[model samples]
Target chain A: MLRVVKPRNARSKRALDAREPKEIEDARIAIFVKGTHTGEVVNNVMKDLMALKRPDAISFSKKNVIHPFDESSPTSGSSSIQSLEFWSAKNDASLFAIGQSTKKRPNGLTFVRMYDGKVLDMVEVGIENFVSMNDIKSAKSTPGHKPLMHFASELFDTHPRFIQLKSMLMSFFNGEEVESICLAGIEHVISVSCAPTPVTLNTASTSADTATSLPKVYIRAYTTKLLSSGTRIPRVELVNMGPSIDLVLRRHRDPDSEMLKQAMRRPKLKKTDVEKGLGKKRKNFEVDEMGDLRGRVHVGKQDLDKLQTRKMKGLKGGAFDGETEEERPTKRIKTS
Target chain B: MDVSSILASHNAKYQLVTVEKETPIEVDAGFLTVTDANSIDEDTFNSNIEEHLQSLARDGVQTLLAKLFSLPTLPSSDGPLAQLPPPTTQLPRSKPLPKIKPLTKWEQFAKAKGIQKKRKDKKVWDEEGQEWVNRWGKDGKNKQVEVQWATEIKLHAAEDHDPRKAARDARKARVVKNEKQRFANTAWAQRAVEAREQRKTEIQRTLAQSRLSTASMGNFDKKLEGEKKLRGIKRKFEPTERSVEQEAKASLALLSRMESDSKKMRKNPTSEKSVLNVRKAVRFASKGEGGVALGRKTAGEKSKKGGKK
Candidate 1:
C-alpha cells in the first residue's frame, strides 16, 4: 500500500527540501493490488509516481530535516524507516520516489518465489500478516505456496532481469525450498552463458503472446558430500541475460548530502518543472545487498502525472553512474 | 583444507534426517558442546572424553578416589572399593582384637564417641572388686570403660606410651579436622537424612493435588479442541486453526464432531438446513450454535428443560 502525503501547500509551489514546511498538504494515496505482481499495475503506479516529480533546491544544513519524525502520523515509522538523520529518506527527496513516508509506517508487500514444477511462480504475504511492532525486523524465510506466486508475477512486471533469473531459479527449486535459491547455495554454477539487456515489457490482460512471456529455465541440483561443504550446484541452461540483473546489490560512493545541499543551493525549481540531475553514488554495496537505489532518480509522483505518457524520463536498462541513455520508455504493449 | 575428514563427519545419531554428502558437518564433540538434538534423544550421545572416562572405570582405574553417596557394606574391598583405607587410625593401636562383650551404657556411650579406653591401671588391692585400666596404646586390654567404676580404679601408663589416652586428650582439645577426615565424620549423616525426608514430603503433596484436580483435568480433556477454540474468543483473536475450523465446521456442532468432520456434513444436506434455520430463527444464537436445538435455549428455558433431561 503506497500513500503520498500532500504538501499542504498543495496549490502553491515551494521548495520541498527547504526548511521543513509547516504542514504537508495534498497527500495522494495509490493502492497497488497491494503486493500484486501485475507489471501493468507497477507500470501504472510507476507512471503515477513519475508525475509527482518537482525539482526543488535544498541548502546543505546540519538542521535540514530530510526526514524528521512527526508524532501526528498514526503509522509513524513503526513499520518503516525512522530516524532524524539526513540520509533517512532516499537520495531523491525532491527527485522521484516510489512513495516512502518518513512519518508513516510503510505498508510493504513481501514477495516469495518457489518452484511449482519447473516453472518459477511467486506468492505475496502482506506486511500485516507478519508479527512486527517495530520499524526494523529480521526474518528467515522458507517459501510456501502463496508467497511464491506473488513473487513470480511481480518479478515479471517490475524487473526484466528477473525473467531469466526466475527461470534459472525455478529449475533449481522444482521441488525444493526457495530460501535456498540464494547464491550461497549454488556452490558450483559457472558463469551465466550470455548477458541480456534489461527489457521492460508492459502487457495488457488476456493477450496470448504476452501470456507465454515467462518461459521456464532448466536446472538440476546434485550433491557430492564426499567432496565437502554440502554444496549443490544446479546446471542451468543459460541464455543472453542482462548486465547482472542484480544491480540492487551494487555499491558506489555518492555524496547524497552534497547533492541535496547543492540542489538546495540553487533557487528552488518551480513545482511545475524538474530537471534531471545525476544522483550521488553509494559508498559500498555487497553483491547480495538489495540493490543501490540511489540512482533511482524517479520524477516525483505529482509531476509525472502532468507529463505525456511514455515521455516520463529516466528508468531504463543501464548501470548506475553510466552516462549514456538508451532512453526507450519502458517497453509497453497493449491489448484490446 | 582437509576435505576428506570434514566430508566424512556425519551426525550418525540423526540417521532419520539423511545428511547430504557434501554438507560440512562439524565433528567437534569431545568434552563440550552437544547440539545435535537426536544425540540426546537416543542416549548414544557420548563425547570422546566421556567415553574414555567410562573405559577408565571399566578397566579398574584405582588410586583414583571416586566419591559415591553410599557404598555396599561388605568386609571385602574389590576394584574401586579396594582403594578405601581402614576406618580407625587415631584409636587404640591394638595388635590383638578385643573380645566381644555385652556393652554397658557408659562403655557404649564412650565407644559411640569413637574413643577407646586406656589399657594398664590394675588395682593394687587384691580381689576386693577394684577396677583396672591399661594405658593407651597397648590394645586397650583389660580396660572396662565406665565412669562409675572409675571411683574404684587405680591408673598407670602402660607399655606403648598410652597413645589412645593421648589421642583422647588431643580430641578433647578443639582440634580441627582436615578435609578428608572431616568428610568421613558422622556429621554428614544429618544432611543425608533431611534430604531424604524433604523428597518424601514433596511426593505426598503432589499425589494429593493430583487427586483433587482430577475433575478439572477431565473437563479440560473432554472439551479438548473446543476449549482451545473458545479461549480468547472474547478478544476477537484469530485461533491458529481458524481456517481449518471454518472449513470443517460448516454445519456441525463442535461438541461431538471431530475436527475433520467436513466430509460427513458434506455427505448430508439436512444438517445445513437445520443450522441455517437455527441461525435465522433463534435469539440465543450462542446456545443454538452449540447444537442443543432448544429454541435457542434462553437461560430460564435451559434451567427448566435441563432439570427434566
Candidate 2:
C-alpha cells in the first residue's frame, strides 16, 4: 500500500529521494485485499489503493511511500482484526486498509488507522454507482467511458463525488470505531457521532439506475488536514485521496500496454546522470609499511628495494620484452 | 736499450699503478714483508752449520725437568724422586714498570681473601635457622631433609605423572567445581550450594518450557491425498462390475451429445444470431474506432442484412 505524508515546506521544490521521511515512520498503512474475492476484484481494489499515493498532499520525505504490491502478499489469509494487527506488526505498518467482498456488500473497502498494532480509528467506504469495465460492451465504441469508467480523477475539490467521498472518509477521525451506517443500497457507512455532516450523502431516495447518477463514487484515499489541538485524539487524518480505478481498464485493444505505460511512470535514475562527473582518472593509491595511507611518493627505502629486486627479476624473466622465440623448430623444417 | 732497462721501466709503471689503487693496509705487513726479507741468498750462504751442541743439550735437559715438575701429583709417582739441578742463572723478564700504583687498600684486601680463605672456616652459624652448619659442599650430604634448600620435586616418579594425567586434569578443571574454594566458612558454603541449586532449577525450567512450547505447536498429521487407510494391495485392484456399466453409459451419453451438436450446427449453418454474434465479436476485436460500426448494432439490422442476402 502506498502511504503518503504531507510535505513540510510548501515552497520547497526539490525532487524526492527513496528514503521514507521520519515523520511518516509511524504512519505507514498496510493495504490488504481479502483472499476470498475474485482475482479481478482484488486486482481492481489494489490498483485503487495504490492510486492513493499522493506524496505531494502529505509532508512525506519519500517520493513514493507506497511499496509495490510485489513487496508483500496482497491477499492475507485472514481478515480478522487480530490477524490484521499481526500482519501490520510484521510489515511495520501503523495503519491498514482492508478490502472485503460479501454477498450483501460486494465492493467493501475499509480504512483503519492503528498505533502499535491497536486500532485507533476505522472507516468503511462502500463503492457504489460506479461502472466497472465489464459493464461496458465495447470500450472502443465510446471515448467518454474511457476515463469515466476507470478511476483517474486528478481534480478532487472540483469533482462533486470526490468531495462527498473525502468528507465521508474524513468523518472517521471524529472518534474511535463507529457503527456501520445503512443507506439504500449500502449496507454500512461508518461514521462517528461528531461527524461534520450526516452519514447519508442524500436525503432523497436513490434512483434505480444509480450507476448513471452524477458525481460518481471515486474511492481514492489520502492523508487529510489533521486537527491540531491539546486533546488526546489521533492527530493524523487519512482522507479519501483520488481516482480509485485501474489506469489500464480504459485501454481499448490492450490493457497490458496501458499497464506498461503506468509502470514506466516511476522516476528512474538515468545512466548519464549517474556517470556525469566520473570521467576523470583517479590518482594511484598507496599504503605505507605501517598500514597508513600515503601517496606513492612516500614509499620507504625497504619497499623500494624490494620493488627494485622484483623489477630486476621481472626483467631477467623477459617480462618487459616481447614474446620469446620458439625453442624448437617445426616438423615442417625437419621434413624440408 | 737492454732487456733489463725495459723490465725496470715496466716494474716502475706497475709500482705507480699499485700506489694509485687502494690496497689493503694489513696484507703487506701480514704476509709479504716476512717472505721478502727471508728470501735466502743462495750464492753466498753457508750450507753446513753445526755449532753450540753442549749449550743446546743443557737447554733441552732443563726444559725436560721443568715439564716433569709441572705434571699433576700422581698416586704412583712417590717412587720417582728424580732430583734436578737448579738453573745456573736466572733469566730477567721484560717489563715497563709503573711510576706509582693506584690500587685501593680495600681492593687489595678483597683480592687477598680468596676462596681458600673462605674455606678455612667451614663450620659457621646459620642465623635464620638458629644452628651451626658446615658451609662446605661435602657437608650437605649430612644436612637435615627439610633444611636442605635445593629439594627436587620428583614429579616424574609420582603416580599422577602418567600419560592419562593430562587428559584427566583437563576434564577435572572443566567440571563444575565447588565455589567455596575461596572461603571455607559455613555461610559462604551454603550460599554457593544454593546458587548451584538455583542454576540447576533454571536450566530444568528452560528445558521444560521448550518441551511445552513444542507440544503447543500445531499437529500436522493430515491424511495424504487419495489415501485409503488399512486397505490392502488386493483391495486396490478389486474390479467391480458396476463401474464398467457406468463407464459405458457415460460414453454413450457423450456420443449422443456430440451427434446432436453436429446435427444442430449443420441445420443452422448461417443462423442470424450466429452472424450477429460473429459481428459483435469482430467489432470487439477491432482496434481504436475510425467510423466503424463497432458493437452498436441490434437484432433488426442483423435480420435486415440476412433478408437482403
Candidate 3:
C-alpha cells in the first residue's frame, strides 16, 4: 500500500503537481537498485547504466533483497513487488533495474517496468561482455542528450518477445519529447543487432522449442560525426563509443493482455492533431498521399440551354454571320 | 491439366502466393522475420522514391506474413494465436562491470600466504548429547559453557570468579573485536578510495599548472599522440529571444531569490545582534593597538609608554 502524502505548503504542492499524470507524460524516471549480493560485474553495469540515465535516474546505494520472480512462493514475490511499488510511488519512477549476482546466475541484470504503480513485466539478462567508456578514449555524448536508437532485426517488429524488449529499451533511453530538434543535437546512436540464426534449427519448430535457441544480441554505442556534404543533408559517420556489451537473454515474464492493453492506452488526440487531419476520418474527405486533405463534391446535372456563356461580338449573329464575314474578301482585293 | 492452369491463374490473382525478386527473401520462421537482401533498382528508386519504398515494404511484409502463417498456432478466445519464441539475439549489458573492492587486511594477508579458505559445517557434534547441534545458535555448542549447570575453574582462579560469566564475557569480547575489525576494514577501504581521488586531483592540478608554466601557455608545446585538448568551463545564458515582459519577470524573480538568500545568510544570531561593528571600532581605537592591547588596557593594565608618560 502506498502512503498518501499531503503537501503542507505551496512549494510542496507545486512539487507534487509536477509528478501528476499529464496528457503528454513526462519522461520516465528509472530507479537503479542493488541486490543483496551484487558482484563486481553487476555493480559496474548498474553504475554505467545510471550514468546514461542521469538527470532522470535515481540510484539506491543500499542493497535490497527483492525476489521479483520467485514463483515458488507467491507471498515472497508479492512482498518484493509491494516494496517496488512503494518505491515507485515515493520516487515517482516507473522503470527499475535490479542488479543481482549469485553463484548460480552471476552478473545478472533485471529490468522491471511498472504500470500504475504495479509491476508490468520483467526481463533478466546476463552480461556476457562489457567494454566501459574509459577504454574507448573518445569523446562521449553530452549527458542528458537523447540517443538515436537503431534496432536492426526484423524480429523486433514481429516477435512478441523482441517487440517488448524493443519498447522497453526505447523508453529506457528516451528523454523528454520535443516537437522539433536541431540536427546537431543528434550526438550518438545506439545500435542493437542480433546474430544470424543457426542453420541447424528447423523452421517448423514450435515456439517452445525455439525459445532456447535464440541468437545472442549485440549492443554497440557510437558517437555520430556530421560532416559537410555537397547536399543539404550532411554525411554522417559513426565513431565507436565504448560500453559495448553482449548480453544473453535468460528469463522473462510477459504482462497479461488486459494489463498490457491498459498500459498501452493513450490519451485523446489534441486539438492541433485533429486540425492537421490526423484524427478520425470524416466521410467524403480524405488525406491523400501528399498529406493534403481532399474532399469530394456531389452536384445535380445542369441544363446546357440555361447555362450562361461569355458574350462575344464575333458570334453576335451566329455561324451564318461569321461565315459571311470571312467570305467578304473583295475589300482586300484592291490592296493585293 | 487445362483446369489446373486456370486454377493456378485464379489463385495468383486472388492470393499473392509468391513474390518475384531477383534475390530470394530469407525467412527465419522461428523469429518470424524476413530479410530482403536484394539491392534497390536505381531507375525505379530515382524515378519515384515513394513507389519504390512501398514496393520494398510490400515484399518484406508479404514474406514475413508467409513465414508467420507457417508457424504452429493454438486456438484461443481471441482466435488462433501464433506464439512468439524467445528472442535469440544477445543484447549488450546496459552497464559496465563493477570495480573490485579493495581487499581487507586479513584477505590481503591470506592472499600473500596462499591460504585457501575451507568451508566449515554449521552443526557441530556434541559428545555428551551424542547428537549434532548448531555451532552458534539455538542450544549451540559455543554457549555450552554459559548454559552448563556446572563448570570447571582454573586452580588459581579468584573465589568470586564464575566460569559462566567469564566464558560469556570472553565470547562478547570476541564479537566486539570482530566488529571493530570490520569497521577498520571499511574505514581502510574508504580512506584508500579518498586517497586515490585526492591524488588524481593533485596530479591534474599540477599538470594544469605546468601547462601554463611555458611562455606561450603550453599552446606551442609538442602534441602527443591521442592527447586531449584542455577544456575550459562552458558558459550558459538565458535565451535572448525571450520577450521583454518575460525577461523582466525572470529578473524580478532572481532579485527576490538573492534578497531571500542574503536574509537567510544574515539570520545568524551574532550577525543579527547590533548594527555597530565592534571589530571595526577596536581597529579604529587605541591608536592601532589591536584588540588584545585594548583588552589589556580595559583590564586596568597600563601600557609601557603610557606608564612612562
Candidate 4:
C-alpha cells in the first residue's frame, strides 16, 4: 500500500506532480537492493548493471535480510514486501533488482517490478559467466544515452518466459520516452540472444521441469561505429564493449491477469488526440503515411443550374451570333 | 618429400595451438577470465614492449576462449552455444552512497516520543455497503457525510441551514489547514539551508559596499587569484550614427513627451504660487512709510541735501 503524500509548498507540489500518473510517463526509476549474503560474483554483476542503469538508478548500500519468495507461507514474505513497497513509495521507483547468493541458489539476482507500490512480478536469474567492462579495453557509451536493444531469437516473441524477460529488459534499459531519436545519440547496442531450446522442452505444453530446462540467455554489449555511407543513413558496425554476461533462468512469478490488466490500463484519449485521428477511427478519413489528414467526401447529386462557372467573353450571352439574350439556351456549359 | 618431413616443416612454420607456460594458466570459468601467473621473460620483453604485451593479452584471451568452449554446448541456429559458469570476480561500486535526508519536525517529534509509524490501508471496510471502499479518492468514505441523503437537524437550526454545505466547508478548511502545516514542516526542514544562503548574500552585499568605499573605488586594488570581477548595471544608449530623418523623428517624440510632462506639472498653479506677499512684507518692515521715504531714511539725508543744494 502507498502512503498518501500531501504536498506542503509549490516546490514540493511540483515534485509530487512529476511522480503522478501522466498521459506520457517520465523515465522509470529503478532501485537496486542487496540481499544479506550476496557473494562476490553477485556484487560485481550488480555493480556492472548499476553502471549501465546510471542517472535513473538508486543503489541501496545496506543489506536487507528478507526473503521475497518464502514458499512456506505467502504471508511470511509480507514484511519484506512491505519494506520494498515502502522504498518504492519513498523514492518513487517502480523497478528493483535484488542480488542474493546462497548454497541452494548461488549468484542469484532477482528483478522485482512494481505497479502502484505493489509487487507485480519477480524473475530470478543465476549469473553464469560475467566479463566486466574494466576487462575489455574499448570505448563506452555516454552514461545517460539510451542503448538500442537487439533481441536475436524467435523465443523472445513465442515463449512466455522469454517474452516477460524481453519486456522486463526493455523497460529496465529504457531511458526517457522521446518522440524522435537522433542517429548520433545511438552510441551502443545491447544484444540478447538465447541458446536453442532443448528438444524435450520445445512442445507447446509447459511444465515445472521445462523451467529448469530453458536455454541460457547471453547478453553482449557493443559500441556502435557510424561510418560515412555517402547518404543520410550511416553504415553502422558493432565493436565489443565488455560486461558480457550469460544468465540461467531460475524462479519466476507471473503477474495475475486482472492485476496485469489494471497495470497496463492507459488514460482516456484527450480531445486533441481525437482531433489528430489518433483515437477511434472515423469512416472515410485516414491519416496517411506522411501524417497528412485525408478524407473521402461523398457529395449528393449537384444541380448544374446552381453551379457557378467562370464567365468568359466568348462563352457568355448566346451560343450563336444571332441569338437573343432572353431566347438563348439556359443550359450550363460543363468544363472539363 | 616424405610425409613425416612435410609434417615437421608445417608444425615449425605455424605457432603452437596450445600456450606453453612454466605455471599453468588459472582459468575462472565463472568470470570468463584467465590469469597467467608465469613471470615475464626479460629477454623477449626487452626486445619489444608492444609485442610482449600483445602476446600476453592474446594468451589470456586464448585461454578464456578455450575454457568457454569446454562448457556444455547447446545446439543453436548460429552455432553451438556454451552456457558460462557463475562469475567469481569481485568489482567495486561505481558511485558513492546516497546521503540521508534531513528529518522533518513531525518525524523528529515522533522519534523523541518513541512513536512507531503504523501503516494504514488505502481501502476501508464499509459497514452499510458491506464492501471495501477507498479511504479518500473518488466516491470515498470521507465524502459519505455530505453525499448521504438522510440528515439530522437541531431544534434551534434555521430553515435554510444546509448540513451538506457545512460539512463540505469544514472538509475544505481542514484540507487548507493540513496544507499550511505541510508548508510549515517544509520551511522548518529548510531553515538551515535558507539561513546559510541569507548569510552568503549579506556578506556579498557588505563586500560590494566596502569595495566601492575605497578612494579609487577598488579599481587599483590587487586582485586575488580566481576572484570574480564585479559587474554593475549596464546602460544602453542610442547609436551615434543614424539617418537625419530618424534622428529628427526621435527628437520630435522626445519633445512631445517633455511637453506632456510639463503640462501635467503645471496642472497645480495655486500650489506653485508663493504664499509670501513681498509688497505687504515691505510695508510692515518700513512702518507704512512708502518705498521712497523708507529708502531715504535707510540711505541717510545725504542724497536729499545734495538735491536741495
Cα TM-score of candidate 3:
0.46
lDDT (Cα, 0-100) at B161 in candidate 4 = 93
Model 4 ranges off by over 4 Å: A1-5, A71-78, A270-282, A286-336, B1-309
The two-chain DockQ for each candidate, comma-separated, is 0.00, 0.00, 0.01, 0.01
Task: Quote the true-contact fraction of every model.
Answer: 0.00, 0.00, 0.00, 0.00
> Where does the lowest 10-residue lDDT sum fall in candidate 2 chain A?
A186-195
For residues A163-223, write the lDDT of model 1, one tens digit per residue. 3343322222221211112222211111111112113233433232232243221111111
Q: Candidate 1: what lDDT?
A: 0.28
Fill in the DockQ of model 1: 0.00
lDDT tens digits, residue span B10-79, model 1: 4332231233223222111110000111111112212442233222221111101111102222333332
Per-chain TM-score of candidate 1, chain B: 0.16
- TM-score of chain A by itself in each prediction: 0.16, 0.30, 0.81, 0.80
Q: RMSDs, each prediction?
A: 41.9, 58.1, 34.2, 38.0
> How would you order the candidates by lDDT, starting with the best?
4, 3, 2, 1
The window of 10 residues in a row where model 1 chain A has the poorest summed lDDT is A242-251
Mark the regions of model 2 whose C-alpha exceeds 4 Å error after superposition. A1-27, A54-79, A129-336, B1-309
Q: Write the per-residue lDDT of candidate 4 for residues A1-336, one digit (tens) a residue.
A: 665779989899999867766544556788889987998888888888888888889999999875667643343455777777898888989889999999999989998887777778888899998888888899988898766555544566567887788767766875244443333355666666666556655564676455578878777777766554433233455677767888998889887777677766555666556557665678997667776667899999989866665566875755643443333454343331
Worst 10 residues of 4 chain A by lDDT: A175-184
